[model samples]
Target: MQKFPFDAIGFDLDGTLLDTFRDLGAAVNHALVLGGFAEVSVETSKDLIGGGAKIMLARAVDAQGGLPADEFKQLYKAMLTYYSAHNAIHTVPYPGVREALVDLANKGVRMAVVTNKFEGFARDVLSQLDLIGAFETVIGGDSMGKGEDGQFLAKPHPAPVIAAREATGNGHMAFIGDSTYDVRAARGAGVPVVAAAYGYCDMPPHELGADVVIDSFPELIPALEAIGSAS
Candidate 1:
């Protein structure tokens, strides 16, 4: 068997490791109703994902003629509250995720989660799904604290990804995710990344700019190996 190249692997949470749009959509709808905006379909919530929970709600609100900043803040808070309480209602690991994680673990590869979601929420969801034990670390958007812009140094910034690598104590790290944020972050961190095409990608899988793309979790190992060989 060809050995996987990276010593540590980092994964994105929402849309990558877990199918969370249903719960996310419900939370968004809860806020929208509170804000007096028409509810969007649960399936439509997938399109609103990519950035994080705040961005998800913001997009949904913006689509409905947007609330004032202060009002939007209130609505966002409400959404977070609802989500925090119900984040794992319909969230689940994509097929083969458990098997792949086991395979990676058996190979002695370190694992971590570097997600744009807030730390508490990510931990909560993973814990509820019984997947939290698979990773050595979980770096959320808030994990790196806010930058000068008062925004999280999350995905696309490389900070959280770098933090994940440092936490894993491995220099040879590969990241896997399903969005531009993940791709850009990995690029910024100077690490190879693989795209999870079956997840809720913000763009077409081919356009994600990943070193390799896998249609499902079962393909992850081979995709990582391919990227390693190319490097």
Candidate 2:
């Protein structure tokens, strides 16, 4: 039951706030078929997703007989386009997530979404779900533009978390997410993190560098209250 002083909370979109793997897996397998590769199991696709679009597509291609660089590049582009259009087809907010978020907002806790998903697609999904209004800021994988030398820094980098903090006008913040990448990003940003064990996680929650592991979104209230009391 670790506690911290924080007035804002940042969330990961896909696996953290929403269960979007069904449409994501469908798009991936559809792209694989169009690219002349065998379809992958949804379970395997789930394991490949939290990283990002390119990483997920690359892993899928590698699983179905690796493709040449040029072919992979084309396929990856197609996959992104296809996924963007189909992102919210069957996606749904994770259990208790909507209620929890609304409750937190009502309590005046600033919230934002920081995701490795593309900015446009992330926004689209949130908009379709009517959740766009819930976040004060939404930072996607491509939002900050390429780095100093044209390199992109996605999750596992502090940029997104720092950007979220800046966007929400909060110096004291906590990150809530589902995977190791989220943990790493929060750590790099020097913020405490809460891991959602109910979401998609490639590894055990305890090993993901979270200060607390919450089994349900509703647990968040108690956790935040404890932190407030401690502070």
Candidate 3:
């Protein structure tokens, strides 16, 4: 097993801790049909996710012949509502996620979730999966408040990573995720990342540039221990 160096760990929710594309794709397709757009396939929708809601809506709209900006905005709003209502309807934690989280928590390692999902939806998903209590903090794409200023800084940006650090009061951190966007975000945050080869990815894991890649969630234990030892 590969090992990493850090004191705390941050995770991307969707493809990292759970496989939530089914519910997200379903809601997106429903919204598209309601918006007078052609329905998209679940597989295609998977490609559209990981960037956040606005980007996902934009891609869905573009797939069905780009709608007028106002129409797109309206559709996006509706989509958000529908998605929030249906967020975890079909979501499930990835294999070994529960065990990995349990083990990490027992070890007294700080953990947080930094996802591009909406705060409400993300919380609902975690609750449904019975994993809400495992994390110290959960920051979604829409978690922007007074200090955050409502900016959507999805993966590939360090804002969410930094936010997680601020929330946990931990400077030495690592990110665990499954996409190039996650890798970029970790890099921008000046943190190392562990890529999950089993999660949803449109491209090869090698292209993501993660500091380490693991095939199973259990493999992260050694890495976490290495981090703890290094710290």
Candidate 4:
């Protein structure tokens, strides 16, 4: 067979490679109850995932009359604590993810994960799932360090995506994700992007402006092949 299209691939963790809504939702509820707030339906976690844990809890709390800043800070901390231990309980690879990943590796494609989750948590969860070994590197939302604005240099910034590409050997690359954050980051990094429509997309798949849209993880290699052919 002819060589594959790209030299490397970068992936987004939650909602893209893994179905983490249930575990993430549980963590959010754990914090909500501690703050004396009503627990949100776990399914609601799908809508709040792309932004990361702090934002996930913030949205859930804000929906119920909101909370004082200091109180909310404490609750966010609580959520993190709870998530650290329970993140992998219900989290698992999406359908065909394993086979696709192995196929890519067999094709000599380097792989890395660029996620909005904190570094430690991302590593821990991936480790628990035994999936960490598949990636050349894992770049978390906090991995790039804070910028002058006192915020993490993460997705929507392109820094992490750029870093992932560089880490994976800096050749032709493509990014796969389910959210606008992923699309924007991949575009900013000047690579073709494939949107994962089956994941918890923050917007309609086509509207996300990816170079291609695929309905499931199994479709990835063909999508990348198409991207390669066009490029």
Candidate 5:
């Protein structure tokens, strides 16, 4: 077999590795109810993801008439509190994720998960699902600390992905994700990227600007091999 395209692969947690919209949506609904807003359909929650829990709740709240900053903050905390306990109850890996991960490991490739979810939350979910051990490290939005504006230096910043590369030995790296955040992060980090079309894509798969777009996790290896071959 030909050499694997990259030495390390950094993956986005939600949408890319796991199907988490149901739990995310539930948390958003919990916050919405607490804030006296109507709950949105769980399916629509797919569109609210990609930023983080706070943003997810914010969007849902905003759609219903918005909220005062103070009230919103409290609601955000409530969402987090509810989520931390029930996050994995309805969450599970997307099809072929486990097999693909195992295959990557057998290829001697290094892996890391870089997500906008809080570090503790990401760790807990992955650990509960028994997928945490597959990664060399799990870098959350908070892992890099907040920037000058008090916002997390998370996706689209490239710092976490670059850090993932460094932690995985820094030879050559690739990113796999499902949103513009992931594409921008990989581009900023100077790595090729594969978009997961089957995941919770915020835009059309072809429009995500990935080096390649895969419809399923099972297509990932072949896509990466082709990308590596061409590059």
Candidate 6:
């Protein structure tokens, strides 16, 4: 077995490991239509991603016209209901993701998924895609529970990423993701992060302030290796 750089690695789910925009967009559209808003192109969901499903739908809806809180809550519920059943419809591992994962596993690297999605939803989607077993744990936005502000203590908060490292039983950890949320989380946790440029990045990948940036999953190992070597 090849020795790896880090003892544990965490990944962001939606865009980093899988292309889930289509299904996410579909859910948003379902909610929007039910709320009497014009449906948006599924492709537009890519721009609304990174913050989670609720935020994704809210962004799309807010684009048309902001909804009343109670009404938006009901629409959000409807979207979750629709998404739970169809989360994997058009979702698939990004190109080279599986191969890269296999390679990492072969190197005996412990891995976890830290996503802004709800824990149950993340697990369900991963399970449906036959990718759940690859992770030692899946830490989601809801996993850390609602904060005093009534918001999820998720990425950009550092709690989930820290939880992932603990769950994976690794002190030396690294994170890979596509969004500023991921970058911020890793930074706040003081862990090295690699940006996935091919994912649904909320900002320019180069602007994410990652320790390294990779254009494809296949580049992950090398990027990690480089980080390791430099350290």
- Structural similarity to truth (TM-score) of each candidate: 0.98, 0.93, 0.88, 0.98, 0.98, 0.97
Overall lDDT per candidate, in order of appearance: 0.92, 0.85, 0.80, 0.93, 0.93, 0.92
Task: Please give, for residues 1-231, the per-residue lDDT of candidate 6 as tens digits.
Answer: 446789899999988999999999999999999999998888877999977888888898899979999999999999999999998999999999888888889888899999999999999989998889999999998999988999999989999999999998956899999999999999999899999999999999999999999999999999999999899
lDDT per residue as tens, model 3, 1-231: 443345578999887899888888888888798888888889767788767778887888886679888988888888888887888778889888899888777656688998888778888889987899988889887675424655566667788888898777766788899887888888998887888887876478767787677887888877655645655
Across 25-117, the per-residue lDDT of candidate 2 in tens digits comes to 988888899998888887667788787888888888887679899988888888888887788889999888889888778767789999999
Worst 10 residues of 5 by lDDT: 50-59
In the order shown, what is each candidate's alpha-carbon RMSD? Answer: 0.9, 2.6, 3.1, 0.7, 0.7, 1.1
Give lDDT tens digits, candidate 1, residues 1-231: 766689999999887899999999999999999999999999978999988888999899888898889999999999999998899999999999999999999998999999999999999999988899999999998899989999889889999999999999956999999999999999999989999999889999999999999999899998888878888
lDDT of 6 at 42: 88
| Clash count, candidate 3 | 0
> Which stretches of candidate 6 lie above 4 Å from their native place?
none
Worst 10 residues of 4 by lDDT: 44-53
Off by over 4 Å in 2: 1-5, 227-231
- When 3 and 5 are scored with lDDT, the better candidate is 5
| Off by more than 4 A, model 3 | 1-5, 145-150, 224-231
- Tens digits of per-residue lDDT for model 4, 1-231: 789999999999999999999999999999999999988889877987886888888899998999989999999999999998898999999999999999999999999999999989999999998899999999999999999999999998899999999999999999999999999999999988999999989999999999999998999999999889888
Worst 10 residues of 2 by lDDT: 1-10
Number of backbone collisions per candidate: 0, 0, 0, 0, 0, 0
